[model samples]
Target chain A: MKRFWCLFFMIWPVLALYVCWIAPSMGWWFPFTGPTGMKAASPLGERIDDLFYMILYITTATFVGTQIALGYVLFKGAAATDEGNTEKAWYSHGSHNLEVIWTIVPACVLLFIALYQMDVWAQYRVKDSFPSETKQGAIAEVTARQFEWRIRYPGLGPDGKPLPLMPEPQPTDLYTVNDLHAVVGKAVMIILETQDVQHSFFLPELRVKQDAVPGLDIPVWFKASKSGDYTLLCAELCGWGHYKMKARMVAETEDKYLEFLQNLTKSQNYDGVPETPAEGAPVASAAE
Target chain B: MRSKLVALVLCSGMLFVCGCGRTEPQFSYREGLSPRVQEYVRTTVDEKFGTPHKIRVWDKLPIQAHTALATVGEGSKDNSLVVDISGASRPIEPGTEVVWVGGTIMPRGSAPVTVEAFTKDKNLLSLVAAPPAAPKAGDKIVIGPGQTLTHGRLLYAEHCQHCHGVAGDGQGPTAPYLNVRPRDYRKGLFKFTSTKEGMKAHRSDLARVIEDGIPGTYMPSFKLLKPEESHAIIEYVLFLAMRGESEFQMNNLLASDYSDASVANRIKDGETQEKVIEEFVTRVKEGEIDEEVNQRNEKMIADWVSAQAEDAVIVPKEKRNASDEESIKRGRELYLSGNLNCVACHGESGLGDGVQTYSVTKNTDTGKDNVEPGLYDTWGNKLKPRNLRLGMYRGGRRPIDIYARIEAGIKGTPMPAFGAKLTEQQKWDIVNYVLELPHELRTPGTGVAPASPATKPAPVATTAH
Candidate 1:
């Protein structure tokens, strides 16, 4: 019983370490790779996945090595105790060459990762590094309040393209409360601002998240290569209403997006002149 | 050997303990549902609505509000009340021949009605509601319960119906146990909407509410739900609201046309109930009833449709009058003003216990004053007027939140809207005064103190635009 118990105790860390290694692939933690699939939807998203896997692989190796070493020490110590020889076993100090190799290898690995992740970080974070298409000015203003997202779209002309940037407010500006609409192939910029408190604008699929500071218009741009809707949720705890900030991103053909804009514009400026020759009033179509 | 054995046991236990994760709020998805309700839901709703799901963008059909003119009853010529609103800065001008604003303008017990109509002399008018159409018996009811419901319906049943109820009546079994009862959507009224005073909530408003669940109540946020699911739930809630409201209208019509008293009288007089029903139908068709019920229905639908239009959210026309001492002083004066009725409920010192707190509970409507006095909400829970000094506002603490509360009054409670009675500046003034109450109480300040210790005036972040 004692021998069996000793063996079991020795293996516990190994099991834990094994579970940690398997957890991500089994969809236990993110970059979730298991049945509950979460995949990269953008270039940055892929880069982030790469950075994550790099850290994960390195961490797993370290974890296994450390745990096995710990288990080996326990096993050897227990064997000594079993023999009733309660003396520190004669141990040799680490070799100078081994120490040099160990230190240099880890340091080199760290250096490589640090240097490799720089561009991905710069492309993702630096405001100026954002795609040039984003500099044409924000296509929408997303004002996040305590519990909801109030989105305003640039007014489009009869040609289905956004009107030119101007210093003044246009009456044709289209507004929708929760849903953010963008053309699939076009780069959309959001001038995110918080009306009351701090909120993070996170689009998990697009790997886009930027804190919307109160009184600051932080520009965040994303271009959806695939045309589909994605979840856009608040990643910050603004208040009790934080969890329910489930807004969505609609990435569709420019025509469908224009139709959505037309509907929104029609709803907001119902009394104003027609922007497009589309149907009577855009039917209260919210679902497409 | 013994040490090894003990170590093995202890090691496994430590391993188990270490595996335990950080604590989180224990949220049950099917919260507070009895087995019976759950089973009934599965059989009735699922079989009928075709299994609930997430709402697609296309599922967001616009809600049309009622906005049709109601015909004045040609018979009630002498029942007009003259409203002297000339003193009120924004006096409502008589529309082009008595247009209906939301629905019918009907006279209720003289106090319950808004101005019915402007006399030709512009002095006397009926209160705003249309004349009560007599209730008639009906067999056809409960439309589309089993039809292909929108994806929102499934999500609503899965998440909301356990507390809100199948009929949106706020009578789910768990309702009785809740302190802040789930909202009853049948009246088509919501408390924390982003809508302006008296305006219907926007679809996005409903969606946000579902996502952000009411913080201090049983309404837990459905944040775990996919965005599509939340949108679907919003649609379903709106659908239920519309359905319940229509049913309420139907009930009103039936009660007016065929009340118990009228039925008893008809039986005593040897007149068949069938005969009365025929007459009622004839009256409806010929537009000979007090007002056309069909027209009122159309108007009701229009009111809902119009609610989807712009101006759903309340925006003050100008920059807010700064919260200076003068404003607070003026607010104090107005709060105690007899017409404002703030003191009657909020108390002289803003402690939330006003003189009317006790009176509001007495059954004046039912004339059962002999019963024990205790204020109860429509949910049948004891109603507590907001403790203004505590400053723990449940709706929110933002100035706009307070503004909305003052202007629209908290729905589902006894609070009455002052938007119709007071100006926007007045509402903001009240907000300032209410916020000041806690501070005044704490330090013996010159002005009104605020409601809670934590209720600091957080700087409002606004768009530079």
Candidate 2:
């Protein structure tokens, strides 16, 4: 029974280590697609994942060290009392030197981590540190309400180029719900706003998360390395229907992105009546 | 210690039993119906459309019943059975699965019987295997290669029941807290539709609403749902709407003579209680009420069928005019024009604060002046005109959507159709103006003079919260 008590404390950390070793292969690491588990689909997201793995390594080392120390003490204590030896137990009230060493070592580790992650932190949250392309203007305005993401994109100009997205909704703005499209391999920005409550816009694949505070316009930027659909969900529990904000962020080439905008414009102006011969003249006149 | 372990296991087993004892979900009837009326509605609806677990598709209600219903006929052997497939929506094919919905052939377990061979002309179905007991004549069976309604009911319960209610009465758990209530399909009326005025909404209109969702409202988009799943949900919604409409029509019939107020009035007019009660019993026995209900149901079905006709959809004669400054100027003139009277409900500057909103109006039903000074829809909810400056079009934001609104008019609201009075070009002009209202600079009344200084200033348009 005494040996059993010693074994119980030692078994958990070993079991935990086994689970961690097998987790990535089992596709149980990060909430993403890929066999190796640490799959970040954006350039910035890759850097973020590096920082995440760094912290995870530090924590795992600390956890293993503490657990071993605990198991060693339990094992020694249990083993000493296993036999019927008449011996007085040795106990101490305090160990000042050991306490000082333990405290100072953790403080140094904390300071090192604080200094190491400064660049990634600045790139993620600081507006001035954003890429040059994103600094020009946002491509779309994403307004998060209780249960949905309403996206507004600037309509095409006469030259067949997208107009700069306006802060306020323009008459020529194209509207869609729960679908966001952006050019791949380049930073695209979106002005995020909340109509009612606080909602956190989270793109799991791109590793981007921002809180859409009411009455505040927050700019969020990300560059997707792959051209595909990524999951966009709300991280904050804004309301009962928070799960209903299941959206998709599509990353494509510049030409394809522009083509999508053109299609949106055509659909936005569709008037049930098929395009008549007279329609071409007005479009030409407007272009001129 | 061993005894403690046994007790612990027993306690956990009890908890597992409790967890497994979940009650089945049920659809609640609309409130305010008398007990008798409620019972009649329940029995009639249930007989046609069975419970959620054993859903029966009533083919006459303009709903797409995916499964075929057939009654077992004579000369049924152990391996095969003859069935009358006249009531089915389509011919049941070979290899289709079958389940007994009525009579003595009870559903046994998870696995259902499948068809080995189907003779179309003879209406015969040979089973792949024999059941524990042979099926009897007159046993009702449902043939299903498609389980649309069942799939829809389960999905609706999981996703839509929180707001749309099990009965589609718009009184679900979260409904009361919402400012814009979920649609009550009981009246068989939808506000946003592309169909012409006085017609039921087209299936595509409902499908669009489900896919894109109604912006500026709590109904979120279900764009992630697969195409087949969406079709099933739409069919289930149609079933609920038809069922609710039947109950509503029956309520209307009872309202004239059997309402609480009507009963009290009869007693006040010196009629004995027994005599008044006898009148109701005699009417029920004579089947007069049943005849009335059947007629109304037929009319309702006809209305639903006609709405799906190709010509029922509204298509503009001409394409949209250009969005140039000249077109905008002409649209502004039409906005202030007395013939269109756009300023009546929509204010002079398109603020949705027109005088009609604050004026007392007579109630169409009671014929008395309403206590509240506001416009109301047929559903008795206070109606507010769309504030053009918001740029949030609930139906849709497309130019064609706005044109349809201007031409056919939004049903069940104070907005009226101008297609009969205005030409297609004029309607397009209004559509362009309305589309540009958000971007247009706000000036006090533009050209129109402000009301006399004595009158209260018009309400300012506040930003949506």
User: How would you encode candidate 1's per-residue C-alpha lDDT over B411-458 as one tens digit per residue?
Assistant: 656677777787777776777676666556544444544222211212
lDDT per residue (tens digit) for residues B1-465 in model 2 = 999999999999999998987786556465554456567667777887676777776767777656567888999887698988755444455667888877765645746788898888887889998755779999888787347687788889988988988888888899988878888888888888999988888988888898889887899988878776787798888888887887788888887776667777888999866776678768878999888988998898999899989999988887777776677778889988999888888888788988889998767667777779987776677777888878888889777788778887888778888889888878877887787777766765463221121112112112233
Mind giving the per-residue lDDT tens digits that candidate 1 earns over A1-288?
A: 556766797678778877886876787764332112466666677788888888988988887787778777777766887656878776987699989999999999999989999998787667768788776677777878756676756566656677643322233445555678887867767778877789999888778898888768777878776777677889998875477677778788878987887665555322112234654443221110
User: DockQ of each candidate's interface versus the true one?
Assistant: 0.04, 0.37
**Can you give the lDDT of residue B300 in candidate 2?**
86
State the C-alpha lDDT per candidate.
0.59, 0.79
Question: Model 1, retained fraction of real contacts?
Answer: 0.01
C-alpha TM-score for every candidate: 0.45, 0.84
